[model samples]
Target: MSMDVRDLGGRPVIIGAGIAGLMTALQLAPEPVLLLSRSPLGADASSMWAQGGLAASLGDDDDPALHLSDTLAAGDGLCDAQAARRIVYAAPAAIEYLARFGVRFDRTPAGALRLGLEAAHTRRRIVHARGDGSGREVMRALIAAVGSTPTIAVIEGFEARRLAMEDGRIAGVLASGPTGPAFLATARVVLATGGIGGLFHDSTNPLGSCGQGLALAAHAGAVLADLEFIQFHPTALDGPGRPMPLISEAVRGEGAVIVDETGRRFLDGVRGAELAPRDIVARAVWKHLADGHRVFLNVRERPGPEFARQFPTIASACKKAGIDPVRDLMPIRPAQHYHMGGVAVDGSGRTSVTGLWACGEVASTGLHGANRLASNSLTEAVVCARWVAESIAGTPAHRTKPAIASDRPSPDPTTVRPLLSRALGVLRDGEALKAAARALLPPAERKDAASDPAAVGLMIAIAALRRRESRGAHYRTDFPHHAAVARRSEITLEAALAAARELAPVLEGVT
Candidate 1:
């Protein structure tokens, strides 16, 4: 029995009540909106966990051109120049819009906006809210603004299971409420569900960001891009913990270095070195350790007091791991921090499927391209969310349609948990990834290209395999030279599945 709705109260339904989702909801024109939070509004959302400031082009020294150049350079030739320029050009206005919602940005004594720097940034243009607690602070303001709005309704702890499409258009979602799974009213569904980090064995992304949205989008036949370009942050707390704690990039901006076991600066030859793009930094570190992560440093050099001031939270987290940032270098490496690839959405955040829009980390807006520059994800979130809202509000909702009834499965947390952990973590070669993907698929349609996780894995694995040379984060030890020519690797479900099957024989050996 398929259920559908045309009037879900008043406004569109937003999934994953994070900063992007909430901000997009607010930007709608008096639209009665439904925001579903899988956990308490702020707790599980990765938007709240971002430590560095929002990247922008506000300073006199910075301009949209500079920002675009940095973004494209970091993207490793996969970034869409127009999309990058559009987002960068919109930065100041987006930041101001947030300020209107009562985001109290840090101010200097002379009443100037305070800016900070992170890796790949040529100027000090990152606008932060609190000291190293920018995400938390910004999220607090947005959540509060949403709470006060009379038209917006937020339901917490309702984990969305799957999207419900009607006649090939998005109607609503099948979500798990407090009691049971049921069909919910979704006029137009927008997935602000964040990136795929918790899918890995080790990640800085909160446990909730397990690519549930990624899998759900793929399940719903959305096109995903650059799936293999996972960003591993340079300095994660390297002590005894299941998931590593992120040491903010601000520490490096304030003069931290990446050193090896002998305190030798191993990154001396690496371009941009410690300040290099994240993928380069991550691979350099991943080289030290074979299986999962890589190793490097967050050296507490000359500007100890300044580094402490900028990254107190990071300093405190390192202290929890029995390391002192002021005295010793924080032994660190890359853990899966951000996903550069996701369900492909255009500038307006619309997917190939109609009425389905995505923003934040969930949508590959082509703003991040192959690699995201430091602190830019947050900027992209605000800019893209506004664009999504503007496009969605003016468009008329489709005529009343019956809502699709959610297929509520009996609880099986353990099944999904393990399935994601082994197969989807950092570092996948052609063979093991294929096995992992194949093992993860449902038995009936393991070969089905459309929704098979194995097929998805094959797509990503083939991209990684074909690259042959190391450029940015997609490094292949087997083929470790940067090719003279560069091209973006995009695969249709069919093409990816064919490649996966062709390479299945080769990848089988790794597993």
Candidate 2:
């Protein structure tokens, strides 16, 4: 049945004012936009934390076909090729759009977009600004451009609580204010809330990311896809912090190799080796670490100073961790950095929930299937958000109706954290997931954890357990083989929990 998109009133209520949110607002230029940011302007958004350059097919030697192929290969048979092609083909235009918006990407001596390399891409099409600061610069330009555009009404510090739905149609979001909760003037809602940081004990996502949008939508009955497939970068600096610091992919792209404590190159088996898909490399690093030895990354063999000069963020992080890029191999471990799956949406970024849309890390547009290729996060954000803006542009504007109270229960943190830590994060098992659900249940017949932050974490754990066969970021030790049919896994909390309990015995002895 065709959704009555007209009932939505189409003003595009966007949540989380990150780069994706900014781009979405700008793309629909001069429209009355209601941008809800959790923090003040340009504070803790994940896009500002990005270090890898933007991936595109902007070079003469590069094309979208190769970009699509690389993205698909990295996705390990789960990527929608049509979506990949469309997004890849739209790269040059996105870059041109950025250029028009005055994003000063890094230039060569003669000055053209100085494209760099990352894992999976066959060509050097990553456009950057200052070395390892493309996201920051991009945000600066986008923010300035959006601020100048008269129609946008920026309201910072109002974290979105839940989407206000009436009779199964999205009206607006009920958000919290400084004093108390208030109704956001919503016509149509767009979720660009970055990645999920609160789910993992160690993550590269900003602390502001708790997957609230995903949780709210899931609670509201939006069909989520590929919740199992969470991408862990093989090389996040394991250290003290709420969200662990990221080690950029540029290190590997610039020739850093992973070596074990015994000083043997463990990734020697894979073709493309360190540059292989993120899942393979991360697993290889995990396996090496499992042998009671820490895996270390070394760029000393290459021109160390040049590599350091090229990737200062990594160099500084390594240096702070007491490793010198010129002398020692940096101790590294695989940690959750990006989530490839989220609230399932169409090409136009419309979710199963009417009048609601999603873009950025929170929305899975079938672009990054099982695993996301490095640098595609930024590219995907621009591509998808642009589509979302355009799709909403023709949507008729209407005032959000009267607010309705939500029935979804909030979580008690004391129980859910350890439960989530045990089940989800970088490792997984079916048994652990089921146990996590049981252990996390409050004895009070609580409906609370149902909408908990850990609820989405449980969803990821359960979905990972359900797709028993090993594929991409989801490594199933019980079913150690890959499935022939690489279907996108979808589920609800109830179905996911049932599946979780069913296989609890299977994942019993595994972590």
Name the best candidate (by TM-score).
Answer: 2
Candidate 1, which segments miss by more than 4 Å at Cα? 1-7, 290-299, 403-428, 442-459, 462-469, 482-485, 491-511
* Tens-place lDDT digits, model 1, residues 238-338: 76685678887876776778777666777789988778877777766766565443355655564576665766677678777777767777777667788
TM-score of every candidate: 0.89, 0.91
Q: Model 2, range 368-412, lDDT digits (tens) per residue?
A: 888898898898898888889988887776776665434333333
Best candidate (score: lDDT): 2
TM-score, cand. 2 vs. native: 0.91
